[model samples]
Target: MNRRRRQWALKKNLLRAAVLSFAVSCASNAAFADDEHRGRDDDHSGRHPKVEHVLLVSFDGLHEQDVARCIASNACPNIALLAKAGTTYTNAHTPGLSDSFPGLAALVTGGTPKTAGLFYDVSYDRTLYAPSDTSCTGLQGWNVVFDETTGIDAMNGGALTHLDGGGGFNPQAIPHAKIDGVCKPVYPHDYLKTNTVFEVIKQKLPGARTAWADKHAWGYDWLNGPSGRGVDDLMRTEINSTDPATGTDYTDVYSHTEKFDDLHVQAIINQIDGKDSKGDATVGVPTLLGTNFQTLSVAQKAPVAKGGGYLDASFTPGPQVSAAIGYLDTSLGRMVAELKQRGLYRSTAIIVTSKHGQSPADHTKLVKNGDTLSKLLESNNYFDASGNFGQANTKSGSLNDGTGLTGTGFIQTDDVGLVWLRDQKQLAAAVKTLKDNLSCNAPGICADGPGAYILYGAPLRARFGNPAEGRTPDIIVQPNPGVIYTTSTKKDAEHGGNAPDDNHLGLVVFVPGAPGAGERVRDRVETTQVAPTILQMLGLAPKLLKAVVSEGTQPLPGCEERRF
Candidate 1:
């Protein structure tokens, strides 16, 4: 965690009266969150008006401005009202590289990518040795043992057959679950080794209830991976075969986004309205409730305007900000209404956040700069068939044409550039050629030898061992800030780096009645602190959840109380 920053969790003294009111008002329903508080007495426990529940909601690509911006644009009134009743982080951020893998890992586990060995979806693992072969059939690089059916796959269907069959997406090659002796599909939750904040709550808050809901791939990243450390029930889009038994949807990925948010809302809404699936518990306050909406595509503060439903291109706010903010507002409105109806609205802790921010997929200045890096590779014969070739694990990989040579193309992932060479013995020659040709390429890259450089590469054997685990890369190239790859397909927004816009996401906390509840805090807080904070609020030991927190890999810091 970042230590050079200001204290983030300064306890507010003014919360006493509010806390007292909370206890009296919610004593009938929520109690110790989970089994961790079994021996504790609700009445005599020193902590007064303690948190009964915590609801964490994560939007896929919402920036802080989505609240304020869409509000001013009149696209999201519900979310704007939420800000009015809570604190908003104008400068909240994610890890350096804003890729989904590390970003979400930092948020839930409070651990950095470096610790989780999650620098990127495809990173360099130093343990296993990769075979020298580079082909489309080579599916050993990523550290994850299983194929996680995140939002991407969920949105498409309940199965990841397409991604896995493509060779490049196969999880069978990963050594962790490599049952070449006997093939067995690994579940999504099996990939994470760290305990999440939820796990802590389960340990400390014996009776308190906890839950989560969020975007596609991101939801699974937390629901089944690191964040699952403590949650009792969850609503996400992960397609794990074992999910059904655990109260998760085993095959509901094809539902609409509104249904996505609504599924959670309806579940909690039913609880708030005082009716369980079996009609057991009466309408009562829950220990926790959470769900997310796509603020990037809808207004977060307004009522759905007839057919104008925000997504209509004819709508105002130029269709971009309107849809995102509007949808966020709609989701919030529904949730708040449900709380208001339950009469337990006074004691709920509601947290709102975005998985990441947005960036122009095709920024003007970025385009010109990317060209410089391209030229450097071309000049170095890096793209030349005689020099570089592909035998990757997909249709895009090189074909082994007898001489151990393949295609002469490149693999552009997130913002990192990967290069494959025909011969391992030619690595030294390639490095020299790149440096010699680098200055001419200029804008897009830096030599990466010493300080302040961007381009870095080495033998897969030297950097990370096995290519089968998807950890090894022959050459690693990071682009200059703001620059992205300009392939045939184009996009208006993109994210996958440590840049400010990419790393800095939005954060909102809305506990029902804490004294600091409605105050907007501009203090910078890292996502890693979230995991510890969850444990702290629930009176759980942070040590138990440390494996999930990002210490060095992310810019987030450990949670600190106000000393003064």
Candidate 2:
């Protein structure tokens, strides 16, 4: 095996060993559960109270700076209230590759992309075969697989057939994966090889109730992992839904998304009242329930003329940003009000965070270089002739119509780009081309503008994993902060890159009676730590998550003393 491959194999073995050991230890502890206590505080400090439920709220594209800006302006009073009663981590970051799937997975799975195997919502996997050559237009290489769906679902993994399975509008769906040798349809959860906090809770506390509502139904399936279905209550909503009232689709825009998020907020309120949002009382109250808000993300990308904030790092939220933040705070306040009304507020823990933050919040820095990298490689005969001329299966709506690439190997690009060459020998030529054409003198040569960086070799291997691992990209091109690889004039910003704004997120943990209320931790913390910390708060073994076991991921610092 090559050196990189050998290193990966070694790490994989060591990880397995570590996981085995942790599992054994947890099992042993379980045997003595009654003798001591499980998820119960052994500390007599009086400050540590029993934590019954954990409500995790993820705000997509919420930057720490955005929170700071909004809070200073009193736009996000609810979030500020939580921060005042808990520990806020100002230096929190998402695991590298700041996309929604991996970003949230890092929080709920307690592992980086390296351990969780969730690179991005739309990532390349060489080992897996495309459902059919006629579908993605490719057989196995560089296909966009987000849990049985394609990159076409920019909302990322809602059920294909319906919006929240609601009968309001016609269904816009993506093709289900058809792996050559695998019988199962490749749902988004299948792409995630690790266990999530929900799965861990089910295994350790079989009666624990769990629920989640997010952008797309399928993308958040990572909560269930390969178990197919695990969340007791799953509220599937499509942010891309068109208004049945006006027949207008607000797919990526914030104003319309806010309406949809309101549905989730109502669901949370109902869940707190011991009823399902669908009015199913048999479902019972969830011990863990939450949803992500997309309004801020929409505001970040909306044009100023359209009443949106500047999508830059300045953190000066404009009218739209200000309004979005206020709306979100109101939604949060509703949840809090319901919890209090139900008398559950005193026993529940609240966690506010973001799956990923958007980059280039400043509009002036926005650069829309129309897929220059793909054009550069396509001209070099790097892509197959079929499938949108070698671009990702994103633009061509045929992703569900069964007219994708007929072969494998292509370049996938957005705000971030990944290059998967057809042959191993082409690596050198590919690198040379990118390096040589990196000059910003021309419009297309280095599309990254001034300070874009190419990540490969050791740096890529360290943060991700060995490129030979099938899922890891051969080359990763992170364009300048504001450089989006699309020519679409609608979008003002994007995420899924290593830029500071994309990686940094706001994180605050609030346990009603926990000791650290009103405290702040300025230390650098990864989103992965949130999973184990939540597990710890619930009096469950943190090692239940494979990443916690494999990576020695711990709960938030100063959390152990407050855990019950």
Candidate 3:
């Protein structure tokens, strides 16, 4: 695509933050709070004269249902107490497909995936335009993975220095090869064509001390990091060299959950102490924090690591839910108590939220290659595991309309499959046959699940359609829910869909005396609005927190927009 088209696409996805009036009902149990009219907190900071400090925490995948259910069960009291103190939006949400990339983009950029150019783990960059089969190879720059799946990665880069290899790239030691992918994402913060909230903050409050921490790569999105889009401190290091002081020991020893829990708790404690061994809160400086948290990252056919399981929607319960609720609660309680002890609880504002939610692991509901669909296709000869689809009985016939296509292969599994054909012309024929034979079966294959609509032709083109692109796969097949491309049996739950439970996630704001916080607010809320809201609390101008492109409208007053 050309620059003109890309610009148009970008405009279409810009996120706008506005007070929305919506129905009072939601899947979450908490009721919506009435919007309060505007009021004033004219008090100035010691010097800044407006907003003094800000903290944002981005947990992995917590849904609105999870919040309500956990709250009722007392699985999370720290967050629950905040709900009672602040305005908790039952309707708070991420973009429809709450995948990580888009979810985090919404969190920091206030832009949708389409607008932010974010897709799944490996997405086709339309602007750069690479084919799907080159194994997505050939890059002008390194593909940066901004993740913090392991505590070691959090403290040091992906180096396992805490154990061996000096905390550098040591995928071999990882329990699973997939864990290597847990490395941080390559954020285009430096390449960002637009400004972010942090840029605005520095422009306004130059003296403020800002910080951030997370298991993910974009921890300090405030400054966006070394690349300099916007961000200050990120807990990571280079590809080689590692020592314990660099933070290699933490992730190397503990799980993502435990490591994050420990890090944040300790950070809170440091702030409370108010001394840097020099014994001076005013003399030197101490206790500055940024958003932080942890969770399982890699996804297999099944869940492993702990807190890994299939998400059965808001109504469905899973053992992992209880474990997650318990761990997160303990962590939050530690944070709050630390604040009170430090005497900063009354003046501090805590914003708690997650990047996305999870989908329960349920294979029975999935429709992949090993299922009845593939069997019927194979028997009918419409599908061939050996890629001999139109010429098995007789090799004389042309495979790609007489193109004499030579290279082809096929990978199959119960959930999804990968078919690489040599002839582009054969794509249409194969698709038609599959729909007529496989989808027409008792269970329709095309719906909202994995196999819903095929992301083929021009949609899959360029990245999939480019004639010269080496990465272009002959074919990319999508499976319905439960159906995955991987043969791993451990993956019972997943995401990457347009499901409500998947789209809606967990969110909490903890502070004393926040109105309607204990319950839910039915009014429509969004992640992009988070930055703006936080800036508002600090008494900063909307633009500083919202960023130049932010679409958030100012809240009415004490009460936000009214919900159900």
Number of the predicted model whose lDDT against the real structure is largest: 2
lDDT score, candidate 2, position 110: 94
Ordered list by lDDT, greatest first: 2, 1, 3
Worst 10 residues of 2 by lDDT: 23-32
Q: Candidate 2 versus the native: TM-score?
A: 0.83
lDDT of 1 by residue, 1-564 (tens): 444233333333445434433111111222112211332322334343455556566776666655656756666666666666555666778755566566667666777554444554433332222222223243333222222432233222234333122222223223233445433333345445466665565566666555554444332443445443455445433323223233443322212334445555676676566554223556343455555554342221122222112332222343434554566567777776666555444445566776565443223323323444445556655555333422233232322111222233344444445544423346567666655544424533543322213333433333323333333345555554444455323333456655445666777665443334335566687776666555544445456665543242222222222222
Query: Per-residue lDDT for 171 in model 2?
Result: 18
Candidate 2, 454: how far from true, in Å? 1.4
By summed lDDT, which 10 consecutive residues of candidate 1 come out lowest?
A: 22-31
Candidate 3 residue spans exceeding 4 A from truth:
1-51, 126-188, 191-193, 216-229, 237-256, 271-288, 296-317, 361-479, 510-514, 517-519, 544-564
Predicted candidate 3 versus true structure: per-residue lDDT over 1-564, tens digit per residue? 689998977765552222322211111212111211111322223221222344566666676776787778877776776676655667777754455655766665555543344444332221231111123233321112223322233332233333222333222111111113332322334323345555556556656444444443332232362236354434332222233455543333224345445655565455445432212343212223454454322221225344344444333344554565567677777766665555455456666777776543332454333344444445445445444522121233411111111233222332333343434466777667556643434433333443345445676543324422422333444445554433344555456554444566677664333334355567677676665555555545555433324444443233233332
- TM-score (C-alpha, index-matched) for candidate 1: 0.62
